[model samples]
Target: MASRRAAGRIVRGLGYTSAAAAVGGGVLYLSYRPRDIPGSEAAAVPPPTYGEGGIFRPPSFPNVKTRAEQIADLKRSSGTVSGAVEKAQSGITSLLKGDANDVQESNQGGKDEPYDLLVIGGGATGTGIALDAATRGLRVAMVDRDDFASGTSSKSTKLVHGGVRYLEKAVFELDYNQYKLVKEALRERRYFLDTAPHLSSWLPIMIPVDKWWKAPYFWAGTKAYDFLAGSENIESSYFLTKSKALDAFPMLKKSGLVGALVYYDGAHNDSRMNVSLAMTAALYGATIVNHVEITGLEKDADGRLI
Candidate 1:
């Protein structure tokens, strides 16, 4: 009888608790419930409507300026600050139009003045030189047999690596020069990614370790690569388990597979990068033209080619 009384008390306690909780919840709901203000009925906003393409189109306001008009007003207010914008727009227009005659006329010097430098080719090397010269305030003229980057520059593998093979040779042959070259290449790789972030990005490459013993070798090599890259390293090298490797690359040979080592490098759109360099050079006061060839050279009495 005493145990039954204890159980009855427990059931009563639970019932009281449940009643309290339900009452609290109902009170909260009523307190936070949305309600119309006394005078806001007339000022109620209409529901948002979807326009074509399923986009939410807000209601238009009166006297809203279009984008072009807004820009014009801004230019008027900013005064001379808009000159830079106009110049950049003109440069873009010139680049798009590819007016060789305009470029030639703009770059022509007086009878006594001569071009500081004349680049014979508009390939990667020549365009890079032109850009450097132009940025340094030199009068530069660049001519190409064909369009910029239309030759070997466009036929690249699109990889910007630090020469892992060179690193390996450096290790095996104890060649300090090869190691230095790798270090410099790695730094250049970082520069390429940083300078043109839109055109270049980090690429993850997997080196399969077919032998169990080769895992340590490849891992050490990749770590060394990262170390050589130093602060310029994009990401650290890592190892992947056999199962993960096979999952990532299904075409791998399963026999004697011992996982893989992955390392980071860089890749870029080579042709686009070259063209951008050329255009940037042109913008920096370098005269660049295409579809011209140099057949022969004549030397003056001073041993200078004319």
Candidate 2:
């Protein structure tokens, strides 16, 4: 797999958002026709919140700021970020233990130490968090109730594809935020194949086009999907003849098959990847522990998590 250059491109600036989904089979990357919504047709809605429901919330201090706002704030506070990792390292220390509640208070680096990050759950999301923080030189610790990737992470279909359905919805609803999400996912899909080649492989998926006319239609969609991926794309998509499609998969019924759209995605061992992330984090000085269920949380006087 070729490494994609980090040629900075400005995708649609939305609110700060992170999405996770169970890896699945090839998405139906059908081309979507963007619909233009008139200015009068837009709905009048309040800003969204980051936390659960809260009534009588103030407009100035919004519970959740959009991605645009978050980026803007980062730019404004750019000077304050120097030595951030060092500070986090000083604040947090060895926080991992077999028992979730077992905090070695007498130890030099114990529960009393100020942690930079406390990642709950040991699935892909949690381990990814721990790895990212540890790599940044932050004091990070992760705890999972059970074994890592024992949940949906291990149960994934294991194909890493851009969410074509989300793209379809974005185009239909004229939601630029959704468009940004699709672009992000596509980029990450490429990253997985590029970084962890040992654990991941390219999977050629065939979209059987039952009707002759539909071949061009589906092919166009996949082309757009490939284009969105840009340098991250694994390989260019191409059409296969009916006989060629049947040859690729002998189980297909030959009667109505007109052609197929063949595209490249990624397949991997989801559980192993999750474990690898945790191990990598541990190697980077993060404390990773499992079978530690967090029954409750502790907070300080300021209502901040301890």
Candidate 3:
């Protein structure tokens, strides 16, 4: 019993788990012993390849550590810790892929946690508020009742659209809103589709026209739509005949669909896109969580409603 306790002390002092485990087996593993580090193993470590100009890409995402520093970690132990570190980075790719499986149901943080601003909701609007505030270098906290975008945001028809149909009417009710929505939608569309090409793309939209005169009307209007969208409208608009339109959509009503006015609109996995938005917020160093309850508000001495 005395020997075992002595072994534990020696193993812990050397900061080696294998040596501690070895003591249980009545043998000390030389590798975990500090003495072995300066022997044959120390000489075996190949000089770093960076100075030798070996082919190695930089780490995939954000890491501030240097190449030599990371290489040094690989030499300290078996690749177990290295592999665990890589596994942790794999979660980075999962995050960039916008997987929400990691979202927690309840948070275990602190109350009265210091934050410059506590955003009250976690819908797209609120999330955007938090993100905008955080990116501007503000200390912020955001909360949600359910998984991010478990509200009107998730139900959005998965199109960053500018209301191509309504624009023809020249509706003035929300003209600036329409313009802002169109510009931002297309801009945001380009951002998402570019980063995750495997999941998002520009889908051709075929608006069937029954009258021949309607073809030019739509072409002109849609071209304007393209202009407003700027570079995000990677493609142009065109009119199609009954045969051409049918070729694009076999399921489209053949007889009633007479001819189609084809235009480009962005499409994506709505849930996946929302998840990506949250991940992007995370990447920018924002604190986010899901399934939180906001039961009260605090007011300052100024008598401002909290």
Worst-scoring 10-residue span by lDDT in model 2:
99-108
For model 2, residues 223-272, the per-residue Cα lDDT tens digits are 88778889887566777778878888999999998988977777889999
Give lDDT for model 2.
0.66
TM-score of each: 0.64, 0.63, 0.59
Q: Candidate 2, clashing residue pairs?
A: 15-66, 15-67, 16-67, 31-221, 91-114
Query: Per-residue alpha-carbon lDDT of model 1 for 1-306, expressed as tens digits?
Result: 999999999999999999999987865554335544222344233467799999997754223233353233322321111133343344445545865334333333232344556678888899998876655445566778889898999998899889989999999999999999999989999889778877887788999989989987988899999999999985677777788799989999999998988888999999899888887776665567777676665556666544
Model 3, 176: alpha-carbon shift in Å? Answer: 5.7
As for model 2, its CA RMSD to the true structure in angstroms is: 23.1
Against the unseen true structure, what C-alpha lDDT does each candidate score? Answer: 0.72, 0.66, 0.58
Number of backbone-clashing residue pairs for each candidate, in the order shown: 0, 5, 0
Find the 10 residues in a row with the least total lDDT in model 3: 103-112
Residue by residue across 1-306, what tens digits does model 3's lDDT show?
999999989978887767776664542231122332112333333454552466765434332223343233222312111132343354445456664233110111123223444566777677777655544444345667778778887798777566776565444465766666766767777776666665566677778997778876777788888887777666666667788778877877776665777677777777766666665555444456566666876565664433
Per-residue error at 74 for model 1, in Å?
Answer: 40
